[model samples]
Target: MNRRLPTKTIALLLAAALLTGCGAFSNDNRVDPELSLEQAKQTAMAMELELAEMIPDENVASVDQSQTGVLLSCDDKRGYQWTGGMNIVVQGDLDPAALVDAIIDRYSTQELYTAKSSPTPDGGPGAHVIGQHGAGYLVNQSPDRTAIEILSFSPCFVLPEGTSPRGNF
Candidate 1:
């Protein structure tokens, strides 16, 4: 005769295995718990300096604080048809991959939101998440930094009726 485990016992075993495999139940506190808007601005400013060096002709138009994070915009000195901007979210030193995963998971569960892994502009790996409202987020993580950049367009800024606004990527 064959002996089988009870249904409840099997379910418990499966849950345990999943939790352990994904470390979802583990108390690993590697992520930084406190991340403030001021700190994020500082980080974004530094990043902007680096970007300036890369593109000497363009200048940062503005830096402003938003409800969720900071915003940085590139000036349209070249009289370009579109304006480009970036929204930054900085969290203190944390595992970038894990942070990206967490954000993706959080958005994936929401209605009208999509999240997926994307390749960074520099050929590095990153995450890209978007909402139904035309707002989008791009995340990149390094050893010392974790940041999310939002790319959005203002309809009023576009001219000629069909030009697409530039992105901060």
Candidate 2:
């Protein structure tokens, strides 16, 4: 049997349908996974090399590498990725602090498509900071103040400890 619905009932049904179709109204949210800790570190390394290439030969006193790796990884309420990275310290005649700043500035100018910088969680002279675009990259000043540390993934998130990216994160 065919029956006509009341105006109020039909309005309610239409509103419900519109709401469901409108993700704006729905609570459903999705985010792409961030680069693993290892990936983040690698990105940072690449950035370091690229920056080194940019500087005039005479300006750079020296380039040293200490420790480089990913530190932390997590998701947040705002729907953004997060990573904590650490850099290997550097020692040289040039201003270590200035060098690090230059590296970071270049990082912001290039590489990161859309990213913001925040204080490094560990806390140190090495411009510690987190950069995020949808995903996250934990960037740390190298302990030596020469190399930058980028923790692309969380240390805790390991793949059998020894399993490599070929089969691990």
Candidate 3:
């Protein structure tokens, strides 16, 4: 039984075994398969509302929360995660620099998130806040600085076993 197999055959077999064992080609990205779909949705919604409240009521124009089961894009990852997000727009005769400072302060004070500001190199619109469980917010302004846009979103995640998705499309 000391016969040596061809190198190519051995390599192919090794590759196949590695792929099968590691799930390298598997489409599911359920890093935490124990997480339930309802739990994920609840986290996303809670974070979305918490972020929305950070803005001053006077500056809020509207808040639109995304529906449940929003598909995660990237054809390969379509069914792996869902979208939980809220979009808000602010418009008025306001000082954006001051608003930005205020927002950053709010994020910093919040126990749920650690805040940071990422301003554009040329001082354009670019800033965000990162929170627990991939929850976060982004703040951007129109080129003309007439309107400021805000978005808060939950982290895309998969549900646990024994349960199907609400809407994975």
- lDDT by candidate, in order shown: 0.34, 0.35, 0.48
Model 2 segments more than 4 A misplaced: 1-30, 33-73, 76-91, 111-124, 128-168
Clash number for each model: 0, 23, 0
Worst-scoring 10-residue span by lDDT in model 2: 20-29
Which scores better on TM-score, 2 or 3? Answer: 3
lDDT (Cα, tens digit) per residue for candidate 3, span 1-169: 1112233423333243233321212232233445445665576667657655656788777666655434332123322334444445565655666656777788788786655565533365444665544444555454444445444334435543455445543
Provide C-alpha RMSD values for all models, in order.
21.3, 20.7, 16.9
| Model 1 Cα lDDT, one tens digit per residue, 20-119 | 3211111221222243224433433443333222211222233222322222222232111111223233434444566567766766787855667654
lDDT value, candidate 1, whole model: 0.34
Can you tell me which runs of candidate 3 are displaced by over 4 Å? 1-35, 68-81, 120-123, 142-147, 161-169
Shift of residue 27 alpha carbon in model 2, Å: 18
Which residue pairs of candidate 3 clash?
A: none
Give the winner by TM-score: 1 or 3: 3
